[model samples]
Target: MRVRKLTFAALAVAAGLSLTACNGDDGTAQSDGSSSSSSSTSGGGSGSGGSEQGGGKDDSAGKSSAGSGSDAQAKAAKCRTDDLDITAKDSTIDGDDEGTVAVEFKNGGGRDCLLSGYAGVDLKTSEGDLSAERSGQESSPMVLKDGESVFFGVTYPLNESGGSGVKVSSLVITPPNETKSFSVEWPGAATLPVTDGSGSSVKVGPMGSAGQGGAS
Candidate 1:
C-alpha cells in the first residue's frame, strides 16, 4: 500500500511539472509573435511615410520644372525687335526759296529690322502750306537687318521761314507686315536769308549756305 501511494504522488508531480512547462512555452511563443507583429507594423509605417515624402518632393519638383518651362516659352515667344532704332543724320536742312527743306534719315538701332516701302517726313509750319514729301525711288521692301542703314531726303518748300518753326511731325516706316510711324523734329530756322541759286545753293540753316541742296 505505501508503494502504491508513492507511485501515485510521483505521477501527479510529473503531470504538474509538464503543465507548468507547457504554460511557460505558451507565454514565450505569444511574446515572440507579438514582438514580430509590432516590428513589422513599425517597418511598414516607416516605409509608407518615406514613400509619401518622396512623392511630395517629386510633385514639387514637377511644378517647379513646369513653371520654368513656361517662363522659357514666354521668353522665346517675345519678339526681339526692340533693339531697332532710327534717327535722322541731319534733322534739319535749309529750305529753298520755295521754303523746301531736305532731311536725311539714318539707322541708329545697331540691330536688324525691316523697312519696306518709302518713308515720308512732314514739315509742319504756321506761315504757309507745308507738305510731307517722300523720295520717289521705289526701294525693294527690305529687312534692314542689323547695322544696316539707308538715307532718304524729303523736300519741304516753305512759304515764309522768318518766325515759324517746322516740326518733322511724323516719319512712316513700312514693314512687310505693318507700318510704324515715329515722331521726329527738325531744327528751327530763326534767321534764314533769301538766296537765288539752283540746287547747289540750298543748305541747312544754323550753319553756312555753301553746300548742295541734296548733299548726303
Candidate 2:
C-alpha cells in the first residue's frame, strides 16, 4: 500500500511539469505573433506615407509645367508693335497751315521695326463743327533698328477756318505687316499759343492742339 501511494504521487508531479511546459510554449507563440502583426502594421503605414509624398510631388510638378506653358503662350501672343517704344520731342507744331510739322520717333526695341503709315487727325472747334485733317500716306518705307530713330514731317494747308490754333488730338503709327496700331496723344496741344515766330522761338502746338491760329 505504501509503494502504490508513492507511485501515484510521482505521476502527479510529472503531470504538473508537463502542464507548465505546455503553458510556456503557448505564451511564447502568442508574443511572437503579436510582434509580427505590429511590424506588418508599421511597414504598411510607412509604404502608404511614401506613396502620398510621391503623389504630392507629381501634382506640384504638373502645376509648375502648366504655369510655364501659360507664360510661353502669353509671350507668343504679344504683338510685335507692343515691343516698340515711341517718344516724340515737341510733337505739337504751331505754324502756318502751309508749312510742315516734324515728329521724331525713337525705337526702344531690341529688334528692327517698320513704320507704314500715320493715323488721321480730328480737329474740333470750341463753338462749331469743322472738317477733319487726314495724314498723307508714308512716302517712303521707314525702318528703325534697335536704338535707332527717324523723323516724320507732316504738312497741312493753312486756311481761314483753321485759325485760333488747331488741336492735334492723336498720332497713329502703323507698322508693316502688323495688325496692331500704335497711337500717341497730344493733350498739351490744347494750350498752344498762336504767334508768328520762326526758328526755335516758334511755338509748336501741343499734340492735342491745332497749329497756330487754328480752331480748337
Candidate 3:
C-alpha cells in the first residue's frame, strides 16, 4: 500500500511540472507578439513624420521661387542723351511766309527711353547768337522704343520781303534735361535768312509723337 501511494504522488508532481512548462511557453509567445506589434507601430509613425518634413521643405522652396520671379520683373529705367540720334528737316508749308523746321529725335540704343519738354535751340548768325523761345505748349512724356522717333517744331518768319535780315549760318541744339549740345548745318535754303528783320521772333515747340503737330 505505501508503494502505491508513492507512485501516485510522483504522477501528480509530473503532471504539475508539465502544466507549468506549457503556461510558460504560452506567456513567451504572447510577449513576442506584443513586441512585434509595437515595432510595426513605431515604424509607421516614423514614416509619417518624414513625409511631413519633406512637405515643409517643398513649401519653402516654392515660396523662394515666387520671390525670385517678382525680383526679375522690376521697373524700367529713365532715358539718357547717349541713346538718341537727332536730325532736322524743313517742314514749311507751300506759299506761306511762316517757316517750320522739324527736328526728329530717334532712339538708336538697345532699350526704351523717356523724352519730354522742348528742345533748346541757338542760331549762329553773323550779327550775334540768337536763342529760340519756347512756345508755351503743354507736353507729355514720350516713350521711345528702339528705332522709334519723336519730333519737335522750330517756327520762324521768313525774310521773303527781300529786305536786309540776319543770316543764320548753323544751328546749335540741346536736348531737354541735357547739358551737351550738337551743331549741325542749316537744313533750309543756304541763301535764305532763317528769320525776318532782326531774327528775334524764333520759337521752339514742344515735343510730339506725330510728324505734323508740335505736341500730342
lDDT for residue 82 in candidate 2, whole number 0-100: 66
Best candidate (score: lDDT): 3
Q: Can you give the lDDT of residue 198 in candidate 2?
A: 38
TM-score of 3: 0.60
Candidate 2 lDDT over residue span 1-216, tens digit each:
999999999999999999999999999999999999999978888788999999999999999898788565522222256665643333335554454444444566666665544423222334322323444332444555667555544444443455666444554544335667566653233423343433221222223232322221
RMSD of 3: 5.4
Strongest candidate by TM-score: 3
lDDT of each: 0.46, 0.51, 0.77
Q: For model 1, name the residue pairs that clash.
A: 94-204, 95-100, 99-157, 99-158, 100-156, 100-157, 100-158, 111-146, 112-145, 112-146
User: What shift in Å separates residue 24 of candidate 3 from its native position after superposition?
Assistant: 24
Q: How well does each candidate superpose onto the true structure, as a TM-score?
A: 0.37, 0.38, 0.60
lDDT of 1 at 24: 100
Per-residue lDDT tens digits of candidate 1, residues 38-101? 9997887878899999999999999999878856552212112244444443435444344433
Judging by TM-score, tell me the better candidate of 2 and 3: 3
Off by over 4 Å in 1: 50-70, 76-216
Candidate order by decreasing TM-score: 3, 2, 1
Give the alpha carbon lDDT tens digit for every residue of 73-186 in model 3. Answer: 645345566777877887777886777788878888788877767778988877778889998889877777888888888877776767566677887888887878888777
TM-score, prediction 1: 0.37
Clashing pairs in 3: none
